[model samples]
Target: MAESGAPTQRESMADRIYQALKEDIFEFRLIPGDKFSESDIAQRLSASRTPVREALYRLEREGYVDVLFRSGWQIRQLDFKQIEELYDLRITLERAAMHKICRLDKPPPALRLLNDIWNPDAPSERAFGSTVRALDESFHCELVAAADNDEMTQVHQRITDRLRIVRRLDFTRPDRIDATYREHAEILQALIANNPGEAAEKMTAHIRTSQEAVKGISLERIREVSQQHRRREPGRP
Candidate 1:
């Protein structure tokens, strides 16, 4: 009960189910093109079919899932054309935000989080993983937010939300993780120096490299793991 005796609101089960499914997909547990029925999700999550169906419908609307027959759902595939478009859009928006950011007399408060992330002894220090990538996504979003433009931040968020499934895979290799950290540090240095031109260049390079890295890892892992799963089937010839 609240201090004023007003009841607190409860989160809907459908929302929970939607986030659970999204997390699984974003982490690659539910790989691209993997299919399952409504019953399958309901049983696995220990939730009723109604909420699962509701969640699937919401995910479908967001381009994360698609309806296959009457009750089947499949995780959407990440292809080169789609990724290229996403990265292109990302570059345009982010570069604009970086320009706006450099015009400011001071950096946004979000820089504190970025500083902590880069520091190993800091509380926010995360190695290469989905968590780190989620932070990376947030960093870009904060960049836009720091521009203080509402609409731009919203659009950047939508793109980043869907791109998470593929973007985080760039850190699969230790070398890639090291490269990301160094590049991020360099980008930060440029931003701190109030050099929009240099920051824009560095940001472009960092994002493009990550785009290429994600393409290789996500595509190859999907193909490699899918083949392994297929071969393990009892009837495989």
Candidate 2:
């Protein structure tokens, strides 16, 4: 019989494979419409087929890949219309959150933390690369959570997760990174003044700007970014 921790080991392997595959998709190493098999990933990652299957299914649930009967798996194509609709829905949720937040007796303490990050005193203190992308996501998610609505926060998080890969592309350019910091600061400032209308407007503009930026991503852009990624980490597959 297997040891008690065997399942844990399998789970760990599955998680590791999941992250690796997700990163590949994020970095455009695995472009949309690319197809491969469980054995392909299992061999490439030096993992077992069980863990590879586990990872692929998780990716499928997240809309990153699709399974094929008696074939294997394929990276899902970008659905621009669906992406646009999601951005629209995200704006709606966040706008509602701002209204709720403004009605609070006292502002949430998370605002202070967000201010520290987005309204940094020095540009030299600013984050770069994937760190900034993660911070950008947290900024929006935190705003929704601050509304004190559990259901809203949960739904917003799912949207954030679904949109993350495309959203990260926005931060790849220096201008977009600068704009994010500036725009996030504007939203925070409006919230501090307890102006829900202004806060919601700024949030909408910020998200729409990000939406437009990422929507411009094309296969050429993906290849360009993928090349840069490979150059940065030659050892990475």
Candidate 3:
């Protein structure tokens, strides 16, 4: 009853749209502060407005977009305040998760997942940054998953999505990339040794250090974009 090669509708139009939009945002194809209309996205993706709307809603919840009044969606702007809040939450949750993982007689599948993503021979800063971001996220997720705590894992998954944006900025910074990889390797060693206290300390320190690095970077670009938006508005006092 279907065309031989056509994708099934049950494949879920909303999911398809979500994946496309998520990738675009993650890869910076849809840069922060870029505005897009739901109607335009629907037409461009050949998707129903329903699916596009659903995808946009999900993106908004994920901190990738914001719904604008009397206009379309605007990509969510990254800021120091959000970055600090995210890292603080991450440090708390990840520290707890690592402690629990270290106490287990045999750590769960998550440890293996983290090990698999480790690469000592990453070629460039860009590649190293990307690798570090992926491995760092996987490491935290695995720790939560290993703890068998569903609520904490869900909380961390949400945190990870927001952290991705920060990681993107941090990883691309030339001075931070090598230091990050070194820190990650140290953390992994502690986790492998089942030293919960050390692991927790290292993770917390790593996050704090990274947060400081982000804060140190000038937000001139973000400020410039903000000014541009303000100027475009009709009547600003």
Candidate 4:
């Protein structure tokens, strides 16, 4: 058992490193395109470079980071094409999940949890504030989790995590926040009413709107960056 425990402990350490790295990225403590060497991370975390490298590869597989040959690793910068693909996949996966929930002989109990937070009468806005976006993401995740389809939930989770970097950016504007609140309420109403068609339609429209919102924000940020670069150029207009 000591031999077996040795491998388990190493795996546990690697997982710990992975979770810590993931949180840092999610919270923007380590923003996109930030670079660091495995040695740096290993020293910072008090672990060996091997586990740090293992953690980074796991992140790379999930599209969270990239390995730089002979250099270091970098938190992945936003990729518009990849993000758009994730949104499309979100629509496809979630539409199917919505259909499944509505077709159920009875609504999944998860709806109760959703309703607790999402009922229009609930004061989630006042309480949640900016965190509303996180809860909104959770609402969709919960649906997939409760759908009783293990395969679907696993795939959905991977896609969801991939898009999380930008998903909340959709709610940055006040109007977008209001729209999300209203849209989520409508979708839940359809589910509660057992109207699969309307629910799926609402899901599709919500995701597309969110996709456009993210793209708009990303393009605006890119323009800002380009203008900053031009201002710094030695010869400029």
Highest lDDT against the true fold, candidate: 2
Cα miss at 8, model 4 (Å)? Answer: 9.3
Q: How do the residues 108-182 of candidate 3 rate in per-residue lDDT, one tens digit apiece?
A: 776665554554454443345566667666766777778778999899988887777556556666657667666
Q: Which regions of candidate 1 deviate over 4 angstroms?
A: 1-8, 69-71, 119-135, 218-220, 223-237
Candidate 4, 1-237: lDDT as tens digits: 024555434457888899889977665557676789998889888999998888999999988998999988888888878888888888888889888887777888898878877777865544345587778778888888776798998888889887776775567677777787788889889988988789899989988988887776564564454455456653211
What lDDT would each prediction earn against the true structure? 0.77, 0.86, 0.74, 0.79
Q: Please give the lDDT score at residue 137 for candidate 4.
A: 77
Q: Candidate 4: which stretches are off by over 4 Å?
A: 1-11, 123-126, 219-237
Tens digit per residue, CA lDDT, model 1, 1-237:
124454656667888899898877765567787889988888888999999999999989888888987757888877678778988999999999889988877888766667567653442355657656766777788878887889999888888987776675466677777777777777777887888899889889989988877766556776665556556653211
Rank by TM-score (best first): 2, 4, 1, 3
Q: Give the TM-score of candidate 4.
A: 0.82
Query: Rank by lDDT, descending?
Result: 2, 4, 1, 3
lDDT score, candidate 4: 0.79
* lDDT tens digits by residue: candidate 2, 1-237: 134665444448888899899878877678788889999899999988999999999889878899999898999987888799889999999999999999998999988889998884678889989899888888889889999999999889878877876786777788888888899899999999999999999999998888888888776776677778788878545
Worst ten in a row by lDDT for model 3 = 118-127
**Deviation of model 3 at 170, angstroms:** 2.4
